[model samples]
Target: MDDLAVAIGLVLVIEGLLWALAPRMGRRLLEAASETPESSLRLAGTLAVAAGVLIVWIARG
Candidate 1:
């Protein structure tokens, strides 16, 4: 859908800006993320998805 495409595009733009403006910090953050536990990552990802859904639902309403 068009909305999904736009959401993906926005995510890319934001991520690209962070990498372009602060590649060093981005790399370090990734490195730290890599060392993080799978459980923690899963929990974080789940929370992010829930939050995103809530945001979209409210916005649409």
Candidate 2:
């Protein structure tokens, strides 16, 4: 749980910096991410699950 929290916090920090430095880019990314196809979204979700599992395994070890 602590590891997951840290990972999420890091993502938040990075995203915040991107928004601060390139707000337009962030908005474009948000729009693109939202308009992504369902199939692409599913693939991205699968990749995220795999990556999260790997991170948890590595951190817990």
Which digits, one per residue and each the tens of the lDDT, describe model 1 over residues 1-61?
Answer: 9999999999999999998999999999999999999999999999999999999999998
CA lDDT scores, all candidates in order: 0.97, 0.91
Model 1 CA deviation exceeding 4 Å by range: none
How does residue 51 of candidate 2 score in lDDT?
93
TM-score per model over all chains: 0.94, 0.67
Candidate with the greatest lDDT versus the true structure? 1
RMSD in angstroms between candidate 1 and the native structure over all alpha carbons: 0.7
Error of 1 at 23 (Å): 0.3
Count of backbone collisions in candidate 2: 0
Candidate 1 TM-score to native: 0.94
